[model samples]
Target chain A: MSKQELTILGRAADDACCQGLASAPLDEQRAADLAKIFKALGDPVRLRLMSMIASREGGEVCVCELTPAFDLSQPTISHHLKLLRQAGLIDCERRGTWVYYWVLPGVLDRLAGFLAVPHSAKEPV
Target chain B: MSKQELTILGRAADDACCQGLASAPLDEQRAADLAKIFKALGDPVRLRLMSMIASREGGEVCVCELTPAFDLSQPTISHHLKLLRQAGLIDCERRGTWVYYWVLPGVLDRLAGFLAVPHSAKEPV
Candidate 1:
């Protein structure tokens, strides 16, 4: 599901070019698509989970390892992970008794590219 | 109010270095602060408003000019703009009948820098 979403998101990102948000006004459809991804990251718990997964060494982390870091319940953490996956920011696999998650390659940079302001659009310092 | 929030956000961004989210796990406070900004952009209406302001020439747009672009009422558009301002993404000033808005100098770039996964973190293509 996320892989499919990522493809759609990739096309949206491509349509806007490098400085997506700042280069031109966004049309409603593209804005709606991007907004869903941003909304997924809007929660503090999800943001923390994203950072944890994104910064993990060796590129992925087990669900067993992730749950211990937060005071929230396992289900709660899993819920956050689900939202991240739905946003196309991360993907996971069930391995034995646990799920392992990794940041989807290039998604973060694509999001960064989308949000970045071009030099010409920047205000004079 | 937005200026004060911008200063605080700047400090948070500086503390994390260039590869903020990908370099290390974010602490609770920083995650909360960054989440608010992302949340502000999470709505399609607000996202559209942000792009319209950020992409405008001369780096600013009048409330009058912004209103006609959407199907929303002026007050509804103003509410979304208020959320953007509260997130420290934009600032505005009233001039007679209209308020003019511009993206806060480097906030978009700062946000992009925070979300960008460093080259080292990228998976081999």
Candidate 2:
């Protein structure tokens, strides 16, 4: 599944979705996929979680480290992490007694590219 | 209301949010604001409408031109537009019989900037 998503992101980032909404009409399927990613980011907790994970040194962080930062229960934090993982914005691996999570850069790049202002559109005259 | 948003955006574009999630932890209020915008973008129908309006030749589009693009009723489209407007992603003006809507580039620029990959992290070398 991770490999498939990598392929999707590679394609999306390299070519399929490099334009902003102002550049062209977004197709239905792409809109659906993008919507899911945005919806996954539609919560404060998850958004903060994503930031913490993405900003961590070594580009990944342990679940044990992550849980302490939130006021919520560990299980609640796990649920938010699960939702983020399901959205393809994050991935995790079990390592000994703890699992580590990291942001999928390709996914973020695709989303950012989609919202990018074209060089022509950068300064509206 | 719009003048206020533009003031906020002008500041946001100039300084307040020039980094991606990986650069720092998003604050509570900013997180809430961004989440609202992302949630407004969570629906497929609304996403399409945003694309259509943003991609229009004049950077603005009429409701009459927008409604026929969807199978949904005018009221349904209007509801989605209302949500998008409330989120500050787009704004509309009533002119005689039709309302014209246009993308708020400052808002998009802010969102895109927030998701942008830091230059140093691009290659991950």
Which digits, one per residue and each the tens of the lDDT, describe model 1 over residues A7-123? 676566566546489788989999988888899889888998899988898888998988999899999998888888877778988878877899987777778888886555454
Question: Each candidate's lDDT (Cα)?
Answer: 0.81, 0.75
Give the C-alpha miss distance for residue A34 in model 2, angstroms: 0.8
- Model 2, position B67: C-alpha lDDT score: 90
- Look at candidate 2 and tell me the lDDT of residue B62: 93
Sorted into a CAPRI-style docking class, model 2 comes out as medium
TM-score of chain B of each: 0.85, 0.81
Error of 2 at B37 (Å): 1.3
What global local distance difference test value does model 2 have?
0.75
Clashing pairs in 1: none
CA lDDT, candidate 1, residue A73: 99
Chain A TM-scores, candidates in order: 0.85, 0.81
Among all candidates shown, the one with the greatest lDDT? 1
Regions of candidate 1 where Cα sits further than 4 Å from its true position: A1-4, A17-19, A118-125, B1-4, B14-19, B120-125
